[model samples]
Target: MAVIATLADVRDTDPVDLTPLQSTVDPEELDSLVRVRNGANGDTHVTFTHEGHAITVHSYGMVAITPEHELTAEKYERGEGR
Candidate 1:
């Protein structure tokens, strides 16, 4: 089977717990986002800023979180986010 890694997994952060982001984003909305994008077509994602961090959650079961400013620089350097 295929293995999907999340933002926490990539960043080596805490486990997959959206409790902290609950205050910033509605849990139900987040759940809906994930549910709707679970298995669709092309790259589908939602971006939001939470606690000064830019967060992008993808459809295939992964989230990318990075500092607002640094995110641009990093993505540029890596030729990502094109």
Candidate 2:
């Protein structure tokens, strides 16, 4: 069976948890590294790494994942129409 790990679980690992969001990247594609930082009022900075390339995303309360790119907090909030 596959194991699902959360940010809190990997906190002390070589890679740290900087966000509360989960990883959805395909393992077959590349090994991934992620970081998340809790921000003001549920805001957070989420970063993902594949190979040596990294992408940062800002999200509030929740995060949206996709195959191509991660969206920023501004974009996420806007999508919510809040």
Candidate 3:
């Protein structure tokens, strides 16, 4: 919800009319990942492009977004882009 809200704000649009977050990320997996990473004290985040921006959700309940860019080549080369 936070991610969606933030994206909507960044894009200056309504949340309900935006494409579903589930289209870009699995809600259950995201919740589980954040919970487990926080429990383990890991510096965890999940990043994906949504609504023309890069959305990164952190384990500390922070949502970050930026304009779309090519950000996966290096990570993919190192096999960590997933």
RMSD of each: 6.3, 12.6, 5.1
Give each model's whole-structure lDDT. Answer: 0.61, 0.36, 0.81
Query: Residue-wise lDDT of candidate 3 within 4-78, one digit each (tens)?
Result: 899899889999989999998898898877653545576688888887788888888888888765455656778
lDDT of 1 at 51: 52
lDDT, model 3, position 40 = 58
Which of candidates 2 and 3 reaches a greater lDDT?
3
User: Residues 1-82, candidate 2, lDDT per residue (tens digit)?
Assistant: 0111333232333234333223545433322222233454465445565322243444432332232333345566678534
TM-score of each: 0.54, 0.22, 0.73
lDDT assessment of candidate 2: 0.36
Error of 1 at 52 (Å): 1.9
Model 1, span 1-82: residue lDDT tens:
0011344454455544433666677756776666544344656777887655677776676677776879778888998977
Kindly report which residue pairs in candidate 3 clash with one another. Answer: none
In lDDT terms, which candidate is top? Answer: 3
Worst 10 residues of 2 by lDDT: 1-10
Candidate 3 lDDT at 61 equals: 84
